[model samples]
Target: MSLLTVRNLNVNFAQRQQPIEALLDINFSIEPGERLAIVGESGAGKSLLGAAITQLLPKPGYIASGSVTLRGKELTQLSPKQWQEVRGQRIAMIFQDLMMTLNPVLSIGAQMVEAIRSHTRIGYKDARKMAIEKLAQVRIASPSQRFEQYPHELSGGMRQRVIIAIVLLLRPELIIADEPTTALDVTIQAEILQLLKEVCESHGVALIFISHDFGVVARISERTLVMYAGKIVEQGATLEIINDPQHPYTQGLLNALPQMALPGQRLNQITGNMPSPSERPSGCAFHPRCRYATERCSQEIPSFINTDVSIAACILLEELVSHEEEPDV
Candidate 1:
């Protein structure tokens, strides 16, 4: 059975003028020990999806439709107290901003002790020992001394590591990591990703890693979901999507990636900005920027078409592939 299942989920925010649809019919599932990555541009609802799963959406934003189930229990219907029990215990999260997640005034040891004690009834001494062990697990140097330091005293990478350590100490069944390495250097980012992958693998923890960087997603995820304007446009095994993207939007994003070519070669870029929530076009949200868009594409939404290892919400895949394989015109 899937560890976490999100079906036909929709999230909306109320505004003075109109209701902003933040997520529309989002659907996906993560199997036990599976590492899934949700990749998209900014405003693609990646972070919003994470918040929805954790039941942490801000006021005025609410789940308008569908269900979120973790271990066969419906999360949406859970009471506040039930949510508290499920959140840090069964489903922990490593938020996007480490500094925001950490308490600036509290020592790392204090926060870690609290997290460890929150779910399990443990004495301060036992919790402190677990905290130190977790800090070492995330590769924090001089874990003993570092545990006594405040968030401000630690470097950016160290702080991120600490946040990760806390989540791992919980040993939750599922973890929703929202851009966990956003604030770290490239080298540190690699280390963090590696640590997360190792932990999830060893503990059979399901991971939903959300990020806008395809390279980062490709590195740590076995499966990938490409989201656009709050909906999934393409999804499949990471290798399949990366090597053979079918959706026009996915193709455009892959094209926009910087290449290690000659200095004079121009880099590819996707033209056109994403539409605002209030001004989202009818039919396919990506129609305006899609190169293969037809008259029908602008008038009707395309259904997801399965392609063995991948699924794409595009009307022109077959034609596009046929044309690509054709000889010179």
Candidate 2:
């Protein structure tokens, strides 16, 4: 059975009584022990998807439509009290900001123990033991000593380790990690990514990784979804999307990778910025920035169509296939 399912999900912001659709008909699913990455430029709603799933949408913004289901349970219809049961127990979120996950006044042990005891009926002593175990599982040296230290006392990497340890305390079934390694140094970033993958695999936890870095996604996730302006432009196996991107946006993202260029050469970059939610275009969100865009693309939104490898939202799949005889662009 699927671990999680999202169908026709929509999010909107009420701006001066006008509804600005932030996320439009989003849909996807993840299987048990699968790692799926959601990649896109900032403001493309990568983080919003995570927030929506956890019922953490910011003020003035709400889920406009659709459902979020986990193991056949409709999360959208659940009461706040019921959602409280699901959040941080069945499904946990590791936020981008470590500070947000840790309380400033609380020591790492205190914060972790609170998280554990909130969901489970364990005493403080048992919860502390569980926290130390998770810390060790994430490869933290001297887990007991680290537990007594405060969040500010640790380095960026150590702080992240504590954050991961806290989430894994209950061994949740699913984890939503939104740019969890973005703030760390390159070496630390790689280590954390690997640690997350290893820990999740050992525990059979499904992961939804939100990131804009294709390299990170390629290394840690088997499947990837490319988002643009709150919509999934393409989704498939990571290798398929990396080696053979179907949508123009996905193609552009892969092409813009630094590895795609020669040594010392200027890196490729996509032209134009992702449109703001208030300033979104009428039809296809990426049409204004796409080189392959035609008049039809600017006037009519594309439907998600199944290619041989990926399901892509693009009107020019036929044209792209016909021109497949030529070299890849």
Best by lDDT: 2
What digit string (tens of lDDT, one per residue) describes model 2 on residues 216-267?
Answer: 8998999999999999999999999898889999888888888999999988
Least well predicted 10-residue stretch by lDDT in candidate 2: 318-327
- Estimate TM-scores for all models: 0.94, 0.95
RMSD of 1: 3.1
Worst 10 residues of 1 by lDDT: 254-263
Cα error, candidate 1, residue 219 (Å): 0.9
State the C-alpha lDDT per candidate: 0.88, 0.90
Clash count, predicted structure 2: 0
lDDT for each residue of candidate 1 in 46-120, tens digit (9 for 90 to 100) = 899999998899999999999999878899999999898898778998887777899998999999999888788
